[model samples]
Structure formats: C-alpha cells, structure tokens
Target: MPYRISRLGLVEIRSLDLDRDLDYYLNVLGLQLTAREGKTAYLKGWDERHAYSFALTESDRAGMVRMAFRTVDPEDLDYYEKRLKDFGIKYDIIPEDYRRGRALRFTAPSGHTVELYNEMDYTGNVLPTVNPGPWPEGLRGIAPPRLDHTLVTAPEPGKAIEFFQTVLEFRLSEMLVAPDGTIIAAWLWQRPAPHDLAIVPGKPGGFHHAAFVVDSADALFRAADILAMHKARIDYGPGRHGITRGTTIYFFDPSGNRLETFGGYTAYQMDPDSRAIRWTQDQIGPAVFYYSQELNETFLSVYT
Candidate 1:
C-alpha cells in the first residue's frame, strides 16, 4: 500500500460573523486569503501548496463545517468509496473542479462530515520551489507555517477509531481508556506527523479545536503574545501537552471557536502492531497536561 492519506487538506469552519473570523484568520493567525465567494472566505497557510487550506463560512453557529483529507493516490478515493458502499456507509462522490478538487463526502460513524480528495490546484507556497529563501517578506501576526491537526468530539470514539484503523489505515498513537475498556480519547496518525486527527468523547457532530503548526516553542510563546495583543481570549497555556509533547497555546476567535498554536513535537510514523501509549483515566491529567496535573472543567465540557 502507498501513502493512502498524506495530510489534511482543508478545514471548512463555521463562524457567526465571517468578516470578523476572516480578519482574525488572516491578521492574527497569518493565513493568506486565497479567495472569497458569498459569505465564505478561503485561506491557506504560508507553506501549503493548495488553492485553499481553510474556509470560513458565515453561519449562526461556530463549529466545523467539514474537514478534508488529501490522499496520496486518486485510486484511493475509488477504493475507499467502494469500501464505504460495501460497508453500507452513505457517501457522495463529488467530481473535480467542484469543491476541493475531486472528493467523496461522507458522514463518519461519529456523525462528523468528512471528505477525501486526491487532487488540488498547485498553488505554490510563499517561497519558490527552487532556490528560495526561508520566509516571505513582512509575514503578519503569528505566521504559523502550516495547519497541523484537528481534534473533534466523537460520542463513540471507539467506533470512529476502529473505522479509521481498519478502513482508513490510520494508526493509533495514543489513547486514554476507561477501566471498562472504553476509549475516552484517541490520537490517530496517517503519516508525516504524530497525529493528524484526535477524537475526544463528546456529543456526536461536535467540534473541539483545530491547530496550526509553528516553527518552534518560541513561536508558540510569540503566538500567545499576539493573542494578548489582539485581545483574543486566552483559553489555556503557554505550556505543553504531555500526549504529543508539543508546546501549545489555546485561544478563542471572535466567534468563540477554539484554535491552537503548536510546535515542538517529535513526529512519529506508526507501523502495524506498533505499541500505543495508553493512559488510564486516573492519570489523564498528566496524559493531557504534564505540568498542571489537572484539567479545567471547560476542557472536558466545551465543544461546538
């Protein structure tokens, strides 16, 4: 098998006020505005090579609209489509030039809308492919290099994990389980990073947070400063996650959707039968936050 799923392509997010959120994404979060249509504004990280890596759509609610995974092979789309059909998983095969190139949209077992695509317009990063400098001129705000990962709330994380394991071929990097053998949370990786997606137990269809990748722990600290300068509510840390060992800071946009700035993690490529780091429920404090040894009530209860 090839690299079936390479990376997450785009995150379509809902905003109560698209203009406000769009400004926050571009000015504070440092994404380039790729396009705009109606109430939706498309954006991309500086290092991404796609027409758009993010979409902010105006809606009454603040949450995820859809998240797409870019596949390594076009045939993987057809292969997964057939797998979905045979498994009785309803899906819609969207043709090219429509949304984000050719894609298949399906509701996962956890009720989150997910898309898989193998094609995208090659919009080069800020630097040229050959003999380019490290960064662009006058980068704005936090200026994270790329979108890293997303953590969503899944009421039945085990089922979602199982589907990702057997069907999508994702490997579990870490999981926190109850004594009854229930998955409280799971981190799943495809390739090139520790986790492309994380599932925490919550109501079906809920969204938790989407994270962006910076260059270093210093960048995360600078991000915290930028958040404070912008008067954005700092939800948590200028600290680290024990799970991924990434320096992170969580904050809220104007619309109250949580976002994170992160870096300083050792990326892992997981093999079949690779040992997963398991944390029992009692030690979940250290599992999530190493220094605090505690979790805020909102960390467990808040979702959109």
Candidate 2:
C-alpha cells in the first residue's frame, strides 16, 4: 500500500491551569506561541513551518484531546475515507480552522481521538530561508527544534495495534510482548524516527507523554539542567532507552501532564522485508529504560 500519512502534524492537550502550564511551555520549553482564541492557545517549535504543532486548551483536567497526522497529499484523505467506510469506521469531517484546512477526525480503537489533514497554513520557521543561522537568537530554556512522537495507553493494545497496522498502514517498529504472545507495548511509525505513535497497556484514552526533539545527548543533559532551573517536576532521567536507543528526560508540566525531551534515535526506513524488533516482558525494564534496567512504579501508573 502507498504511504498515506506523511508525519505527525499536531497534538492538542487539555490543561487544568492554562496560565501555569503555558508559562512552562513558553519559558521553560521555549515553544513559540502563534495564536490564541478564548481558552485555547496554539504553539509551535522554532523550526516548525506550520502555524502550530501544539495546542493547549483550558480545562478542568489534563490529558490529550487529539493527535493529528499530516497526509502525503489531499487525495490521501479521500482514499482513507473510502478505506474507513469499507472497514465500517465512523468519522467526522472537520471544517477549516484558523491555521489548518479541512480534517478527517475519528476515534481510534484505543479511544484516542485522531485527525488527518493535508493542508496547514505555513508560517515559516524562526530563521529566514534565504540566509539563516544555525539557530535563532533569544532562545530560552531547552528550545527543542521540533515535536517528536507521542505515547498513549490502551486497555487492549493488540487491537489498537492491529487497527493502526491494517487500517492506517503504519509499520510496527518495535514491540514488547508477554510470554503467551500478548502485546504489552508496541511502537508504530509512518515517518523515519523510530515511532510516530506508541501504545502501552493502561486505561483506555490515557495520555502518557508527548516528546519534543532535541539535537544530541549533550542537549538531553542540557534539558535536564533547564528543567531543574525551572523547578519542573522531573519524572525520569537523562537516560537511554533500549527500544529506540534515544536519550531522554521525562518531566511534567504544571498541570501534571507528562512531557519528554528526546534525541539520538536511529531512523527507521520502511523496508518491506524488515520485521519489528521484539522484547519479551521479562526484559521490559531494559526495553523501556536502558540505564536503570528497571521500571519506576510511577512511570507505568501515572498518566493524564
């Protein structure tokens, strides 16, 4: 099948304390605020070309509202619509918004809202395309370059994995399976950086973390310093992950939503003959946190 989805485009998350969470996102994480309407604020990385890749909305609770993926072309949306119809999946057509075009929205088998779109209003990057420096000046905090993948929780991850693989055409990159062949966790991707989405066993519709991309291992450590300076809740380490081999540090926003700054993962090409790397449940600790070789109780239990 032709690759329909191009890459992860945007994620909208709810915040219990918008002002407090927004402060952390702006000063500590260094996301550029693009626009605001009512209780919602839209933001993007300094290097993102789209109008916004992250949206924070005021709410009484914290969790993800939806995640969107950009399609390869406008026609791909129509193609997927047909496939969805054939599969008896229900969806809605969302009209154009401030900086985004029409979107097709649906709830995944995991109960997470998902959107697919082909057009977004281009606002350009922080630097000029003609003659740009390595980075923009006045950069604060960690200042990651772009948004990375997201991890969510599902009661039946195997079914969710099947939906993404068979319906959305995402390739499984890696997975953690029980001894009896049940899926504990699975990583699926359309783009090159290991996983665009990952699913773990938890409450349906649970939000784990949305990761941002830093440049290197040094940058990952720098992120730790910045998080400490801002007094953000550091959930886990400036450590390595055996799954993607990425350097990472997990932290929480003021609203208690988990976030991560990650780097150094090997790019995954969609090779037809390639099979997903597997990790048995006995090795779950190393599969998730390479440095500790153990799972923290909070890491698996806590989610927005």
Candidate 3:
C-alpha cells in the first residue's frame, strides 16, 4: 500500500520556564504566538498554514510531551486503527481540541507518545494569497519558513524504526550501522524531505531536537549570527552534514530543549525501490558533522 502518513504536523514540548521559552520562540526563533490556553502556548512559522505547528506547555521538567503527524486523508486514520490493532498496539481516540481535530494517540515502541491526525484549522500564511510579497515585513530573529523535521531517541532504535516503517509506512532514507550490524541511528521519511523523523539510541522518551527550515545557506549563516546576538547556547553547526547534506545550527532554548535551524538538504521521494544511504560506525564523525569531522560531547549527551 502507498504511504498514508503525509508529514509532521505538530510537536508539543514541555518547558520548565514557559515565559522565558515563549519569549525565545517569539523574538529569537521568530515564531508567531497563535494562542494560549492555560499554561499551553501554540505557535507557528510565518509560512505555515496550520493554526499552529509547535506547542509549549508549562511543566516542572523539560521534555517532549508528544509529536503528531498528519495523514493524507481523514479516512486514513481508520486504516491506521486497523494496523495498530493488528500489531497489538494500544491507542486512544482524542477528541477535537483547540484548532486540531480528533486524533489517534499511541505510545510507540520507543516510549514516545505519537499522535496521528487529519485535520487542523487553516489560518493562512502571513501574506495574502494573491500578489504576495517575497516575505512579510517586521519579521524578527531568524524567522524560518516552517518546522522541518524532528529527531528523538530510543534505547533500541531498530525497534522504533520497525514501528515507523511497518505501521506508518515511513521509508528509510539513511542509517548508521555498527560493525556487528546493529543499527545505531535511522532516518525515516514519509514526505519528500530526507527525513521527517529520525531515531537514535538514547534514553527512552528523549528528544534530540526539532529542526526548522530556513530559505538558503546564507539564511543559515544569518541564523547563526542572530543566535549569537541573543547569546543563546549554540550546541553545534553553521556546518554541513554528510548524511543529508544539510546546513544546520543547533542551539538550546531557555528550558534546555535543543532546537535546530536547518536547510539545503537533498529531498528523498517516496519510492519503494530507493536504497537507503548507510554510514558505518567507523565514519561516524564525518557522517554526522561533515565540516568538523567529529561529534561534540553535548550533541549526543545533552537532550531533553
């Protein structure tokens, strides 16, 4: 069967300091605050049409609450329900909340809370549909175009990869393997981007980073400048990746949640016969950070 899961729609992350994090998201990352219900704040990129794509909820600790993907059609939820049942996975039917429609919420093998939904109220982009300018005026910080992809951690990445490939029909784009044939990390995609979701071996429920896409390579450099100006903790990048060939800059939010501004990656289409690119553990250094040819300690160890 063809892939029914379309793309990543929303990511809800927890914040120990909601106000500070909210300010970073608005003034630094350049996301528009769309709404606030109690302790939760909803936000979206200027170019996004959904009511919101990223959400921040107040909590004592920092981590990901859940990540959601949108299906190709409303009925696709039914197809997934059957698949989940057949795989003996349990799930809940979440009623419409805020601007989002009802959804199927489940816990994956990696212990991450995943949600699949089909509808979100469209709020349109920042510009008019017809005769729109190149970009909106009064943009702040490193205003990215949209939320791109996310990387989360699992103790056994292979099992999480299996769940995505088998249950959601996400195809593998790239993977890192050990000499003994253990899968160290895997990048899987439903959309044309290199990876809509990636998994690496770490503590269960760990969120590595959520990436946002900029316009070009120059934009990525500008993003680094903006991040430096704000004195945000820069984790890595303003460099290239050997895996996806993308330019990236990794930084931390106020609550220690890592986030990335990424761009210029090769797009991978949904072709069944397409072979996944592989990197052995020996080349792990260059595979992850092509320019540095090494991994930073915090890149792997520090995650929310």
Candidate 4:
C-alpha cells in the first residue's frame, strides 16, 4: 500500500430540517455545536480532537452527502491523487476550510462521494492534556466518544470492496457471501477495529446508517431511554450483533435517516497474513441480530 487511512473522519449529512436535526444531534446525541458556516452546521463529540466531525446540510431529502477519512501522512493526498488518476477516477482538490484544511473529494464505485484528507482544525477534547479523567462532566444523552463506522448501500459490493481494498488500502474484516460466492456485504477497515466502513447490498448511492460507538452495552440501553423520551423512531437493536459481536441499537433521526449507537465488539487484529471471516447468505439474519436470529424486513429494506 502507498499510504494508510488513519481513521473514519467527518460524515456530511443531508437533512430536511437542518435545525431540527441539529437540535437532536446536539441535545440528544450529545455532540457539541461547533459552528454554523453558510448552510452547513458542524458538530463534534466531546472527545473528538478535530474541530468538528459531523456536518448537516439542509436538503429536500434525508441521506448522506459524503463520508471522509484521514490519512496517516499529510502528504498522502498527493499520493492518492496519482493513484486515483491511474485508476481513471476523476477527483478535485478542495483547499482550506472548505470542509477542513484541504481535501480530495471524489466519487467512488459505489456511487457515493468520498473524501480523503489529512487536515482538520484541531479542537481539544475539553480535558486537560495531563491526567485527563475517563470522561468529561455534564455529558448529555448517548454521548459517544467518536464516530466508529458507517454502513452504506451499494449495488455492487464486490466492486466497492475492490476500490476500498486496492486503492484506499482498507482490509476486509468480514463479509456475507452468496451461494455462488458473490459478496453481498462486507466490512473493511485500516484501523484495528472490525470495520470503519461497510458496504451493504442495495440501490446504488443509498446510505443505510452511520454508527457511533459508545463505551459499553449499558450505553446502548441508556441511548434507548433517550430515544424513547424524545419519541424518536428506533428501527432495530438494543441487541447484539453476531457479525462483529457488538451491541447495537438502530434508530431514526428526526429526518428519518437511520443512526446506530453501538459498542463492544470482539477485537480484530490483522497482519499481512490475515484473512477475512465469511458467512453464507443463509445465516444473514442471525449474523446481524444475534438474539433474534432473523432479520426484520424493515432492517433489510430501509435506507436513505
């Protein structure tokens, strides 16, 4: 690999009522409202080191605008530009503060916009750098530390996997393969976690859900309380997933876009010799919902 993607970075979201979503994200999700520049409102978790890790843009419909990741090396942007060009993908270089300091935004094989950039405005985690405690005081609802991963729907999971694996250097963590060995869903990551991104089978350009990782299973239960208090729509979860063995809850934001609060997965570590874990399509339901041992139609069909 020419370079490495350090972690999942900012996610740009499109919402029907930006203010309504902003209120939910800030008050219910416990993210801080960092700034409102132009039509986009930015939010960051209390523990995020970046200025803001979430962006909400008002739109006619609710969905994802794009997802981004940071690079291990700041100069990796130029290296990615070359790699994308060699692969015949058109891309643009966005300069400072457009999204962050500088970025390379491009369309991926999955028909979703993706950005790669190493620069972001560093905003401290609101704790002293020396002897910081486990958490900050007065933290609000759901209050996850940072973004863990996101799942997007794509027409061709295999193609998307190829782009992620070969171009961006994401390694496969797990996947669901059909009887004929066609990959229908896949989890990929460059980090130590199980996944930073997952491609699920659906219409091209669809976004399934973005998951924010909490510290434990108890956090998911608490998140359920907050969602119920606000009368938020929860699609699935307060259940554990056999796939990653992580506890999760799938709920809808005010805009009807699905959001997941999750935590506690079996740790995954990889080496050059590592291989992906696979599941047959017959086991899909239980793979996703460990307790249910079956997937609900809504879970399989819903996407923004």
Which scores higher on lDDT, 1 or 2? 2
**Tens digit per residue, CA lDDT, model 1, 1-304:** 4557888887888999888788888899889888889988988889888788788889999889998998888898888888887788778877874345778989988888899998898888989899999889888998887888899988788898888777777887899999998877899887756788899888887888888887576677788889999999988888778787777788887888888887735344467556678889998887777779888778878778
Candidate 4 wrong stretches, greater than 4 Å: 1-3, 265-272
User: Model 4 shows how many backbone clashes?
Assistant: 0
Question: Which of the numbered candidates is closest to the native, going by highest lDDT?
Answer: 3
Candidate 4 lDDT over residue span 14-117, tens digit each:
98998888889988988888888777998877888888878889999989999999888887777888888888888888887654778888988999999999
List the RMSD of every prediction in angstroms: 1.6, 1.3, 1.3, 1.6
Can you tell me which runs of candidate 3 are displaced by over 4 Å?
265-272
The TM-score of predicted model 3 comes to 0.97
TM-score of 4: 0.95
Cand. 4 Cα-lDDT:
0.84
1 against 3, candidate with superior TM-score? 3
Off by over 4 Å in 2: 265-273
- What C-alpha lDDT values do all the predictions have? 0.83, 0.88, 0.89, 0.84
Query: What TM-score does each of the candidates earn?
Result: 0.95, 0.97, 0.97, 0.95
Instruction: Summing lDDT over every window of 10 consecutive residues in candidate 2, give the lowest-scoring window.
Output: 264-273
Pairing residues by index, what is the TM-score of model 1?
A: 0.95
Record all residue pairs in model 2 with backbone atoms less than 3 Å apart, i.e. clashing: none
